[model samples]
Target: MADFTSRRTLVLRRFARNRFAVASLILLVLLFVGCYTLPAVLPYSYEDLDFTALLQPPSARHWLGTNALGQDLLAQILRGMQKSMLIGVCVAVISTGIAATVGSVSGYFGGWRDRVLMWLVDLLLVVPSFILIAIVTPRTKDSANIVMLVLLLAGFGWMVSSRMVRGMTMSLREREFIRAARYMGVSSRRIIVGHVVPNVASILIIDAALNVASAILAETGLSFLGFGIQPPDVSLGTLIANGTQSATTFPWVFLFPAGCWC
Candidate 1:
């Protein structure tokens, strides 16, 4: 207990000492709260349209203003944010989880398993993910389904990290602790989960965080291309796509969601 307490204290001290990380964490928390909570308290719904107030700028009644459709921009932005945040977090977790699992297994098992997995990774890495998504999204057309979007983003995002994880696992699997576990006849699953995965976890943690940003950008790009999160539903990408025409005249429509998305 004492040892664990000291470790926890040490970690907290280290984290707190990192001014940038501390600031980033605080800002992230605030942004999340604003995205998820503020919309509920606001009087406007994204769908609620007021034809009389079409293209109105920010006002007391419509805080962020109204779109050409007269729908509340604030509500739309909040809704888009809700979806964007969900997609980012889900894709990051799914992709990183897959990379860690596949890489660990391929590396630890070696031979045929390693060859097959590496071959698959090389194939995927060679192909352009954006082009693949563009071609596939039309057939699937599950843009409205958040789960489908998450799966699609995760499928494209894991290959590079999986290769990295594989290298890390290859190095770690031959270490003394791993050799001891193998000699003690610990199950491959247990050793991989308990030993190999944890050693590479710091890399995975940072990778996952970066992947969150990547996932958001990917989703936004797809949506902007008229592929992701379909109409009446807004993602940051879809919001930007919808507002492009008005960018010159009604810059607020284009900028509001884009700003929140960034």
Candidate 2:
């Protein structure tokens, strides 16, 4: 417990010393708070149409201006941000969990387990995930299908991370602690959970962060192409795609959402 505490403290200290990471974290936190909280106080909802304010630039009455349909840009941007953030976070966590479980199990118990898991990973690695997702996501038009979108994103995203975890676990399984746990008659599950997984957590943490960005971009791309999030639902990609037509005349529509997405 003491060792774990010291390790955690050291990690926190290291994180704090990194100015970019700290700033990024602060900005992310603020964005999250703003996206969720500011919407209630805003005069317009994403769905509200204001025919009078169509294509209007940023102004006091319509803070981020109105889109072609007269929908408030700020309201839509915040709503889009909320959806994008949720999808990104959910996909990252689910994918990382799947990777860690499959990789650790495969590495700790070799032979058939390793062969099957690695074979699955290789198969997925070769499959065109983007094409598959694009083909399937459009079919799911209901608002409830957002969960399906998240699952699909996570399903196709874990292969590379699983391979990395498998390699790390292969080395970790042979370490003294792992060997000692085995000799003491600890269950394979406990040894993997308590000993092996914790050791490789650093890599998993990094992978999850990268996955968040990857998932968000993947979603944005799909949404831009009109296959993701669907109509009546807002996302940064959809906003950007919608904004592109009038980009020359009404730059605010594109810029505000694009900036929020970035």
Candidate 3:
């Protein structure tokens, strides 16, 4: 209990000292809240467009002004944030989970399993991730299809996490506590879940946050290129792409979405 309390206190103190992490956390929370509330409360749907109001400047009625299609820019931006964040989170979770699990098991077990998994990881690392995503996306156009694409992105992206976790597991598996647990007949699953996972969770969390940012950027790139989230679904990338032609004349078109991304 004392040890647990000490660790908890340490975490709190570390978080307190880490201003960037705290700020990022706050931003993350605000983004999530915006994603949930903005779409529901918005004056118009993302697809609702009025050509008559095209390219209007920001005003009380149209908060961020109207796009070429005269859709409410603020509403589209809010909805786009939702979609971008959703994709980012999904990719991060799926990728990290797969990587962590495979890495932990391989590192703990060793032998042929480790060799084979590491080989696969190396193979994935050698290939171009964006190319793979482009190739896989057109196979379907449903939400499930987009989700599958995200998963595929995650799967290919896990090599870094796998290597990191494997190294940590190598050191951890040799520790006195691990040996003691083993001698006490703790099952492998218990040792991994109750001990290893908890110990490595902090690193995993940091990596996951970084990975989320990367995934969002990746999705944005794909969408900008006309391959990511489809129409009726306005991602930041798609919004930027839509506004690219008139960037000089209507800078708000790209500026608004890009601001949200930053």
Per-model clash counts, in order, read 0, 0, 0
Model 1: ten consecutive residues of lowest lDDT = 137-146
lDDT of 1 by residue, 99-209 (tens): 999899999999999999999989988888888876676522354556776887899899999989999999998899899999999999989877787677766766777
What C-alpha RMSD separates each model from the true structure?
Answer: 3.2, 2.6, 2.8
Candidate 3 Cα deviation (angstroms), residue 60? 1.4
lDDT, each prediction: 0.83, 0.87, 0.82
Ranking by TM-score: 3, 2, 1
Q: Write the per-residue lDDT of candidate 2 for residues 48-116, one digit (tens) a residue.
A: 999998899899999989999999999999998898888988999999999999999999999999999
Prediction 3 global C-alpha lDDT: 0.82
lDDT of 3 by residue, 46-160 (tens): 7888777889888887888889889999888887788778888888888888878988988888999899989999998899989878877864347887778788778777898
TM-score of 3: 0.89
Model 3 misplaced stretches (Cα beyond 4 Å): 1-19, 139-141
